[model samples]
Target: MSKETRLREEIVTVGRSLHMRGLSPGSSGNISARLDDGWLLTPTNACLGELDPGDIAKLDWEGNHLAGKPASKEAFLHHAVYAGREDSGAIVHLHCTHSAAVSCLDCLDPHSALPPLTPYFVMRVGRLPLVPYHRPGDPRLGEAISGLVGKHSAVLLANHGPLVSGKTLEAAGYAIEELEETAKLFLLLRQQPVRLLDEEQIEELRQTFGAQW
Candidate 1:
């Protein structure tokens, strides 16, 4: 198979995995992977569990549709991240229940976001910013992500979902899953007065993993 063909298959495979794992339901997520000439993305309103490789949409770097099915309505957000972050090769956004529930709470810190619940989270996700709420497909949502593209690998859209980007689609999906797991842990442990990792431990993990900000 050609590179584009392989990417399309991979996107569909990952999309099914996300849906099956309950990261997204009822077409509530979107995914995209950069291509040599452009990009391949999941179709709009399509159930991720049933995606076909041939139906993945193609778009130019400037967000122009090049071929295949209509792209996800929220494609602009992915484009914004890719445009601003040169290292980004794939992006995934999921309406995972735990993460979305956490986003609704006003307590999330905008700066040092996504508490360092575990060393893996600190190493993979780093700080996950909480972007202010915006209606789905609102152009302003893309604008908001554009500001944090270079700094954050993942962000929680307030009351909506989490968006994550990485050097590959698998890496992006893994990071988003980590975000959801961390959010679930946070919610579960919030009432127990748990002792989080100290700054020294966090720094040690960061140094050991060479975590990028």
Candidate 2:
């Protein structure tokens, strides 16, 4: 199979995983992988649980739809991150339950939304900044994500969900899963006093694992 064909299959597989696992429901998420010329993105309003590899949209680097279904409206959002972080090979944006709940909370720190609760969380999804609220599909939202590019591989959109980039499709999918799990844990332990990883320990992980903090 060609590289593009493999990428389309990867998207379908990952999207189904997210849907079955309750990370993405209805048509509330978008997934994309970088292409040599542009990108292969999940079609707009397509259900993650029902995506067909043949229906994936192909677009040029300049954003023109070349074939298949129309691209997701949030294509610009993916483009913004790719433009900002050349290292990113794929992007996953989802309205997973816990992450969206966390986004709706009023008092989260914009710099680091979630604390260092687990080593895997810290390693997979480093310091997650909470982006300011913008209406879905707004152009400004993409600009906001672009602003955090290299420094943060992931961001939780205020009143929305998590958007994560990775060096590969699987990496991006795994990071977002970690983010959602951590968000669920955060909510579960909200009322209890929990021991978060200290700065020293966090630094150690960052240095050893090269986590994007």
Candidate 3:
């Protein structure tokens, strides 16, 4: 298949997976992938489970609707990340339940990224900052994400959702999934007083996986 065709298929596949896994309900998430001339994005209010590959919206770097149907209303968040970080080729945003629940807690560290629950989380997600809450599709949400784009690969918006960027759409989707899993783990372990990985092990993982931030 052509590159664009493959990207469309990938987006559809990932969107369905997110819906099936309960990471995003109804039309609560948006995804986008970079293209040579512009970008392809999911449509506003489209059910991710029923997303049509051919119907994905296209836009230029400036967020102009170049082709296909109208772009996602959350398109600004995707554009902000892409414009702020050259390394980000794809972006995924999801209202996964566990992550959203954790975002509501008062004790979670807002700046520590994701906690070192597993080596995979350390390697794949690193540190995910907590961006303060903003109304859905609010311009301030994009502004908050823009500040952390160059430094972090993922962020959890307070009372909002997780936003992840990656070199590819699959990678971005995987990171967002990982974030949800990590949040689930955190909740499950919170009452048990579990032993976290030691500082030495965490440092070693950091050396091997690079910085969490």
What are the per-model numbers of colliding residue pairs? 0, 0, 2
Worst 10 residues of 1 by lDDT: 204-213
**Full-model lDDT, candidate 3:** 0.86
Name the candidate, 1 or 3, with the larger TM-score value.
1
Candidate 1 lDDT by residue in tens digits, 12-39: 8999999999888898899999988998
Judged by lDDT relative to the true structure, which candidate is superior, 2 or 3?
Answer: 2
Candidate 2, residues 101-125, lDDT tens digits: the string is 9999988999999989999999999
Q: Where does the lowest 10-residue lDDT sum fall in candidate 3?
A: 204-213
100-193, model 3: which lDDT tens digit per residue? 8888887878886457888777777888899988988798898988888788888888988788999999889888888899999999988787
lDDT of each: 0.88, 0.93, 0.86
Error of 2 at 134 (Å): 0.8
- How many backbone clashes are present in model 3? 2
Best by TM-score: 2
By TM-score: ranked, best first:
2, 1, 3
In model 2, which residue pairs have backbone atoms overlapping below 3 Å?
none
What's the alpha carbon RMSD for model 2?
Answer: 0.8
